[model samples]
Target: MSDMRGEVILRVVPRPADINSNGHIFGGWVLSQMDIAGGIVAGRIAKGAVATVAIESMKFISPILLGDLVSVYAHAERRGRTSVAIRIDVVATRGGGAETVDLTSGVFTFVALDENHRPRLLPDA
Candidate 1:
């Protein structure tokens, strides 16, 4: 992974329950973390309610093993009138030396929402 300028949004350890049959952390679990991280960044940018509109792209670079300390990082990558794209990256620190591995990366899109849950204009940055 290249130098990511995103902020650390979440840090979690994968439990045994998160492991798949293949002995790796479930991909769905990583995806959930990415979504949560993206939402947090989007909400801060929107300064209000926001909803996930799409996961534009995702890449799994490495498998997350049990006992890995997973960190989700995210930043607002793009912004439109009412929508923002957040770039999310997941990294795993393993083997006690804290060797870092790039686990996954994704781009998630979110839209500012009004009280009625419809798209609303984003405020000036």
Candidate 2:
């Protein structure tokens, strides 16, 4: 759906060390990846330090087992003077096949900050 404000930015397969005892990718691991991927886009827009201010509606639709390639997509859904709301989607390929199934999704809000850690004007797009 084009209306969905998300884009695939990074893709990687989890290693055995990334999995929890449940044999699925750890939630923290996935969240960190999302943060990293989300930062890439947010930084360009913010033109400075961007801090995560909020996370909403995170849903893990399926377990991501080790060796399954995971894809993370993030997009700017809303923008303000010093903040941007981003949507992140995580998907895992079932096999070596091209098909992918969404595993997690959430809205992450980031605020642009200056060197002193205060909200700053967003650089022009």
State every prediction's TM-score relative to the real structure.
Answer: 0.95, 0.89
Clashing pairs in 1: none
Candidate 1 local lDDT, residue 1 = 27
Which lDDT value does model 2 have at 8?
A: 74
Error of 2 at 95 (Å): 1.6
lDDT of each: 0.92, 0.84
Give the winner by lDDT. 1
Backbone clash total, candidate 1: 0
- lDDT per residue for candidate 1 within 14-112, as digits (tens), equals 899999999999999999998888889999999989999999999999999999999999998899999999999899899994599989998999999
lDDT for 120 (candidate 1): 97
Clashing pairs in 2: none
